[model samples]
Target: MQLALPGFEDYDRVCEGLQEKATKELIASYTDGREMNPSAVFICKTMINLSRNFDILNAKGRDTSRVMAQLLSWFQELEDKLPRASELKPEVAALLGEAKA
Candidate 1:
Protein backbone atom coordinates (compact mmCIF):
# COMPACT_ATOMS: atom_id res chain seq x y z
CA MET A 1 0.00 0.00 0.00
CA GLN A 2 2.78 2.42 0.91
CA LEU A 3 4.48 1.36 -2.28
CA ALA A 4 1.37 2.01 -4.32
CA LEU A 5 0.71 5.41 -2.76
CA PRO A 6 4.12 6.75 -3.62
CA GLY A 7 3.95 5.22 -7.08
CA PHE A 8 0.66 6.91 -7.95
CA GLU A 9 0.06 10.63 -8.40
CA ASP A 10 -3.71 10.76 -8.40
CA TYR A 11 -5.47 8.45 -6.01
CA ASP A 12 -8.88 8.92 -7.56
CA ARG A 13 -7.44 8.28 -10.95
CA VAL A 14 -5.81 5.14 -9.67
CA CYS A 15 -9.13 4.00 -8.28
CA GLU A 16 -10.73 4.72 -11.59
CA GLY A 17 -8.04 2.65 -13.24
CA LEU A 18 -8.91 -0.20 -10.94
CA GLN A 19 -12.56 -0.02 -11.96
CA GLU A 20 -11.87 -1.85 -15.18
CA LYS A 21 -10.43 -4.91 -13.47
CA ALA A 22 -12.46 -7.83 -12.11
CA THR A 23 -9.92 -8.23 -9.32
CA LYS A 24 -10.89 -4.82 -7.96
CA GLU A 25 -14.58 -5.57 -7.73
CA LEU A 26 -14.50 -5.50 -3.96
CA ILE A 27 -13.03 -2.03 -3.92
CA ALA A 28 -15.31 -0.72 -6.63
CA SER A 29 -18.30 -2.08 -4.81
CA TYR A 30 -17.82 0.47 -2.05
CA THR A 31 -16.64 3.48 -4.07
CA ASP A 32 -19.94 3.99 -5.77
CA GLY A 33 -21.50 7.41 -5.03
CA ARG A 34 -18.79 8.26 -2.56
CA GLU A 35 -17.11 11.63 -2.50
CA MET A 36 -13.53 10.54 -2.03
CA ASN A 37 -10.95 13.15 -2.81
CA PRO A 38 -7.46 12.21 -3.88
CA SER A 39 -5.78 12.14 -0.46
CA ALA A 40 -8.57 10.27 1.26
CA VAL A 41 -8.66 7.77 -1.55
CA PHE A 42 -4.94 7.36 -1.31
CA ILE A 43 -5.10 6.72 2.43
CA CYS A 44 -7.90 4.21 2.01
CA LYS A 45 -5.98 2.34 -0.66
CA THR A 46 -2.85 2.43 1.46
CA MET A 47 -4.59 1.01 4.52
CA ILE A 48 -6.20 -1.76 2.51
CA ASN A 49 -2.92 -2.77 0.93
CA LEU A 50 -1.10 -2.61 4.24
CA SER A 51 -3.58 -4.89 5.93
CA ARG A 52 -3.59 -7.30 3.02
CA ASN A 53 0.19 -7.46 2.58
CA PHE A 54 0.87 -7.76 6.31
CA ASP A 55 -1.53 -10.66 6.42
CA ILE A 56 0.37 -12.40 3.64
CA LEU A 57 3.70 -11.78 5.33
CA ASN A 58 2.39 -12.96 8.66
CA ALA A 59 1.11 -16.12 7.05
CA LYS A 60 4.49 -16.65 5.45
CA GLY A 61 6.11 -16.22 8.89
CA ARG A 62 8.02 -13.08 8.05
CA ASP A 63 9.11 -10.97 11.03
CA THR A 64 7.71 -7.55 11.90
CA SER A 65 11.10 -5.83 11.66
CA ARG A 66 11.61 -7.24 8.20
CA VAL A 67 8.27 -5.87 7.09
CA MET A 68 9.03 -2.44 8.49
CA ALA A 69 12.39 -2.44 6.79
CA GLN A 70 10.81 -3.35 3.48
CA LEU A 71 8.26 -0.56 3.80
CA LEU A 72 10.95 1.96 4.78
CA SER A 73 13.13 1.00 1.86
CA TRP A 74 10.20 1.50 -0.47
CA PHE A 75 9.56 4.96 0.98
CA GLN A 76 13.22 5.86 0.57
CA GLU A 77 13.11 4.90 -3.07
CA LEU A 78 9.98 7.02 -3.47
CA GLU A 79 11.83 9.95 -1.94
CA ASP A 80 14.61 9.47 -4.44
CA LYS A 81 12.11 9.59 -7.29
CA LEU A 82 10.03 12.55 -6.10
CA PRO A 83 12.27 15.28 -7.44
CA ARG A 84 11.85 13.84 -10.88
CA ALA A 85 8.28 12.60 -10.48
CA SER A 86 5.86 13.96 -13.01
CA GLU A 87 2.75 14.01 -10.80
CA LEU A 88 3.49 13.57 -7.10
CA LYS A 89 3.74 16.55 -4.80
CA PRO A 90 7.19 18.02 -4.15
CA GLU A 91 6.03 18.52 -0.57
CA VAL A 92 5.53 14.78 -0.16
CA ALA A 93 9.16 14.58 0.91
CA ALA A 94 8.15 16.39 4.07
CA LEU A 95 5.72 13.61 4.97
CA LEU A 96 8.56 11.11 5.43
CA GLY A 97 9.60 10.29 9.01
CA GLU A 98 13.29 10.95 8.40
CA ALA A 99 12.49 14.35 6.91
CA LYS A 100 10.12 15.49 9.69
CA ALA A 101 12.73 17.16 11.80
Candidate 2:
Protein backbone atom coordinates (compact mmCIF):
# COMPACT_ATOMS: atom_id res chain seq x y z
CA MET A 1 0.00 0.00 0.00
CA GLN A 2 1.10 3.52 -0.70
CA LEU A 3 1.39 6.09 2.04
CA ALA A 4 -0.07 9.51 1.48
CA LEU A 5 2.30 12.35 2.15
CA PRO A 6 0.97 15.26 4.17
CA GLY A 7 0.35 18.49 2.31
CA PHE A 8 2.24 21.66 3.15
CA GLU A 9 -1.01 23.61 3.18
CA ASP A 10 -1.92 22.23 6.59
CA TYR A 11 1.41 23.19 8.06
CA ASP A 12 1.27 26.60 6.43
CA ARG A 13 -2.20 27.22 7.77
CA VAL A 14 -1.23 26.27 11.30
CA CYS A 15 2.16 27.96 11.38
CA GLU A 16 2.46 31.55 10.29
CA GLY A 17 5.37 33.32 8.57
CA LEU A 18 8.42 33.09 10.80
CA GLN A 19 7.14 29.97 12.51
CA GLU A 20 6.68 28.24 9.18
CA LYS A 21 10.15 29.25 8.07
CA ALA A 22 11.62 28.01 11.31
CA THR A 23 9.84 24.70 10.99
CA LYS A 24 11.12 24.17 7.47
CA GLU A 25 14.62 25.11 8.53
CA LEU A 26 14.45 22.69 11.45
CA ILE A 27 13.21 19.92 9.17
CA ALA A 28 16.13 20.58 6.83
CA SER A 29 18.60 20.50 9.67
CA TYR A 30 17.29 17.15 10.86
CA THR A 31 17.30 15.64 7.41
CA ASP A 32 20.59 17.05 6.15
CA GLY A 33 23.37 14.48 5.62
CA ARG A 34 21.08 11.82 6.98
CA GLU A 35 19.15 9.03 5.36
CA MET A 36 15.77 9.85 6.83
CA ASN A 37 12.29 9.16 5.54
CA PRO A 38 10.34 12.23 4.49
CA SER A 39 7.54 11.18 6.84
CA ALA A 40 10.03 11.00 9.68
CA VAL A 41 11.26 14.48 8.82
CA PHE A 42 7.71 15.80 8.90
CA ILE A 43 7.06 14.08 12.23
CA CYS A 44 10.26 15.51 13.68
CA LYS A 45 9.34 19.00 12.54
CA THR A 46 5.94 18.68 14.19
CA MET A 47 7.50 17.41 17.42
CA ILE A 48 9.96 20.28 17.42
CA ASN A 49 7.18 22.80 16.98
CA LEU A 50 5.13 21.18 19.73
CA SER A 51 8.15 21.17 22.03
CA ARG A 52 8.75 24.87 21.47
CA ASN A 53 5.14 25.63 22.22
CA PHE A 54 5.28 23.46 25.31
CA ASP A 55 8.29 25.40 26.54
CA ILE A 56 6.50 28.66 25.98
CA LEU A 57 3.40 27.45 27.77
CA ASN A 58 5.43 26.24 30.72
CA ALA A 59 7.35 29.48 30.95
CA LYS A 60 4.09 31.40 30.93
CA GLY A 61 2.75 29.28 33.79
CA ARG A 62 0.11 27.71 31.61
CA ASP A 63 -0.97 24.10 32.05
CA THR A 64 1.22 22.04 29.74
CA SER A 65 0.84 18.59 31.14
CA ARG A 66 -1.20 17.55 28.11
CA VAL A 67 1.40 18.86 25.69
CA MET A 68 4.13 17.20 27.68
CA ALA A 69 2.34 13.89 27.45
CA GLN A 70 1.92 14.30 23.71
CA LEU A 71 5.58 15.13 23.23
CA LEU A 72 6.63 12.08 25.19
CA SER A 73 4.24 9.88 23.26
CA TRP A 74 5.65 11.04 19.97
CA PHE A 75 9.17 10.37 21.12
CA GLN A 76 8.25 6.91 22.29
CA GLU A 77 6.52 6.07 19.03
CA LEU A 78 9.50 7.23 16.98
CA GLU A 79 11.92 5.39 19.19
CA ASP A 80 9.97 2.20 18.84
CA LYS A 81 10.46 2.40 15.08
CA LEU A 82 14.22 2.77 15.30
CA PRO A 83 16.62 -0.06 14.73
CA ARG A 84 18.60 -1.57 17.54
CA ALA A 85 21.64 0.48 18.55
CA SER A 86 24.13 -2.05 17.26
CA GLU A 87 22.41 -2.03 13.87
CA LEU A 88 22.20 1.74 13.53
CA LYS A 89 24.86 4.27 12.54
CA PRO A 90 26.50 5.98 15.51
CA GLU A 91 25.36 9.40 14.36
CA VAL A 92 21.81 8.21 13.87
CA ALA A 93 21.83 6.59 17.28
CA ALA A 94 23.13 9.80 18.78
CA LEU A 95 20.40 11.80 17.12
CA LEU A 96 17.81 9.40 18.48
CA GLY A 97 19.22 9.90 21.95
CA GLU A 98 19.03 13.68 21.53
CA ALA A 99 15.37 13.22 20.63
CA LYS A 100 14.92 11.36 23.93
CA ALA A 101 13.97 8.28 21.98
Candidate 3:
Protein backbone atom coordinates (compact mmCIF):
# COMPACT_ATOMS: atom_id res chain seq x y z
CA MET A 1 0.00 0.00 0.00
CA GLN A 2 3.00 2.27 -0.35
CA LEU A 3 1.99 4.78 -2.98
CA ALA A 4 5.15 6.78 -3.31
CA LEU A 5 6.60 7.16 -6.76
CA PRO A 6 10.35 6.92 -7.21
CA GLY A 7 10.93 10.66 -7.05
CA PHE A 8 8.86 11.00 -3.92
CA GLU A 9 10.84 8.27 -2.24
CA ASP A 10 14.00 10.17 -3.11
CA TYR A 11 12.56 13.37 -1.77
CA ASP A 12 11.52 11.74 1.49
CA ARG A 13 14.95 10.16 1.86
CA VAL A 14 16.62 13.53 1.46
CA CYS A 15 14.33 15.08 4.02
CA GLU A 16 15.09 12.30 6.44
CA GLY A 17 18.81 12.94 6.09
CA LEU A 18 18.54 16.50 7.34
CA GLN A 19 19.60 17.36 10.89
CA GLU A 20 16.88 17.99 13.47
CA LYS A 21 17.64 21.70 13.73
CA ALA A 22 17.72 22.05 9.98
CA THR A 23 14.40 20.27 9.66
CA LYS A 24 12.86 22.50 12.32
CA GLU A 25 14.26 25.57 10.58
CA LEU A 26 12.79 24.44 7.29
CA ILE A 27 9.35 23.84 8.82
CA ALA A 28 9.54 27.16 10.69
CA SER A 29 9.92 29.02 7.41
CA TYR A 30 6.32 28.13 6.51
CA THR A 31 4.71 29.04 9.84
CA ASP A 32 4.71 31.43 12.76
CA GLY A 33 4.21 30.65 16.45
CA ARG A 34 0.45 31.13 16.29
CA GLU A 35 -0.19 27.89 14.42
CA MET A 36 -1.30 24.77 16.33
CA ASN A 37 1.31 22.69 14.57
CA PRO A 38 3.91 25.35 14.08
CA SER A 39 6.56 22.75 13.35
CA ALA A 40 4.58 21.09 10.51
CA VAL A 41 1.52 23.10 9.71
CA PHE A 42 2.32 23.09 6.04
CA ILE A 43 1.75 19.33 5.87
CA CYS A 44 -1.63 19.73 7.52
CA LYS A 45 -2.54 22.51 5.13
CA THR A 46 -1.38 20.45 2.18
CA MET A 47 -3.45 17.46 3.29
CA ILE A 48 -6.54 19.62 3.44
CA ASN A 49 -5.88 21.17 0.05
CA LEU A 50 -5.14 17.83 -1.58
CA SER A 51 -8.28 16.22 -0.23
CA ARG A 52 -10.33 19.16 -1.40
CA ASN A 53 -8.97 18.95 -4.93
CA PHE A 54 -8.91 15.21 -5.53
CA ASP A 55 -11.48 15.55 -8.30
CA ILE A 56 -9.44 18.18 -10.07
CA LEU A 57 -6.37 16.03 -9.81
CA ASN A 58 -8.19 13.05 -11.24
CA ALA A 59 -9.47 15.13 -14.13
CA LYS A 60 -5.91 16.16 -14.89
CA GLY A 61 -4.90 12.46 -15.25
CA ARG A 62 -3.17 12.44 -11.90
CA ASP A 63 -3.51 9.40 -9.66
CA THR A 64 -5.74 10.98 -7.08
CA SER A 65 -5.99 7.93 -4.86
CA ARG A 66 -2.26 7.42 -4.89
CA VAL A 67 -1.63 11.04 -4.11
CA MET A 68 -4.20 10.93 -1.35
CA ALA A 69 -2.59 7.82 0.10
CA GLN A 70 0.74 9.60 0.11
CA LEU A 71 -0.75 12.60 1.81
CA LEU A 72 -2.39 10.36 4.38
CA SER A 73 0.93 8.70 5.12
CA TRP A 74 2.62 12.06 5.54
CA PHE A 75 -0.21 13.23 7.76
CA GLN A 76 0.14 10.20 9.97
CA GLU A 77 3.89 10.50 10.12
CA LEU A 78 3.55 14.06 11.30
CA GLU A 79 0.41 13.59 13.34
CA ASP A 80 2.02 14.71 16.58
CA LYS A 81 3.17 17.91 14.89
CA LEU A 82 -0.04 18.46 12.92
CA PRO A 83 -3.08 20.41 13.96
CA ARG A 84 -6.28 19.01 15.34
CA ALA A 85 -9.83 20.15 14.69
CA SER A 86 -13.00 19.77 16.69
CA GLU A 87 -15.00 20.95 13.71
CA LEU A 88 -13.41 20.09 10.39
CA LYS A 89 -15.78 22.16 8.28
CA PRO A 90 -14.74 25.38 9.92
CA GLU A 91 -11.11 24.35 9.77
CA VAL A 92 -11.39 23.65 6.07
CA ALA A 93 -13.15 26.97 5.50
CA ALA A 94 -10.41 28.76 7.34
CA LEU A 95 -7.82 26.96 5.26
CA LEU A 96 -9.58 27.96 2.07
CA GLY A 97 -9.82 31.55 3.26
CA GLU A 98 -6.12 31.63 3.99
CA ALA A 99 -5.43 30.42 0.45
CA LYS A 100 -7.04 33.52 -1.00
CA ALA A 101 -4.36 35.73 0.47
Per-prediction TM-score to the true structure, in the order listed: 0.31, 0.48, 0.35
Model 2 misplacement above 4 A: 1-34, 85-101
TM-score of 3: 0.35
Highest lDDT: which candidate? 2
Which scores greater on TM-score, model 1 or model 2?
2
lDDT values for all models: 0.47, 0.63, 0.54
Query: What would the per-residue lDDT of candidate 3 be over residues 1-101, giving only the tens digit for each residue?
Result: 46887768655344232223333454455334435644465665565455545545755677677766865676566655544443357968689679888
| Segments in model 1 whose C-alpha atoms lie over 4 Å from true places | 1-35, 65-101
Candidate 1 per-residue lDDT over residues 1-101, each given as its tens digit: 23455756566444332212422454455454455566546644554554455556666678656544554454444334332323346566446434657
**lDDT, candidate 1, at 53:** 58
lDDT of 1 at 27: 42
- Cα displacement (Å) at residue 54, model 1: 0.4
RMSD of each: 15.0, 9.7, 14.0
Per-residue accuracy of model 2 over 1-101 as CA lDDT, tens digit each: 34446774455345343433554565565446555666665667667777777766766789988876886676565555543566688998889799995
Report how far off residue 68 is in candidate 3 (Å). Answer: 1.3
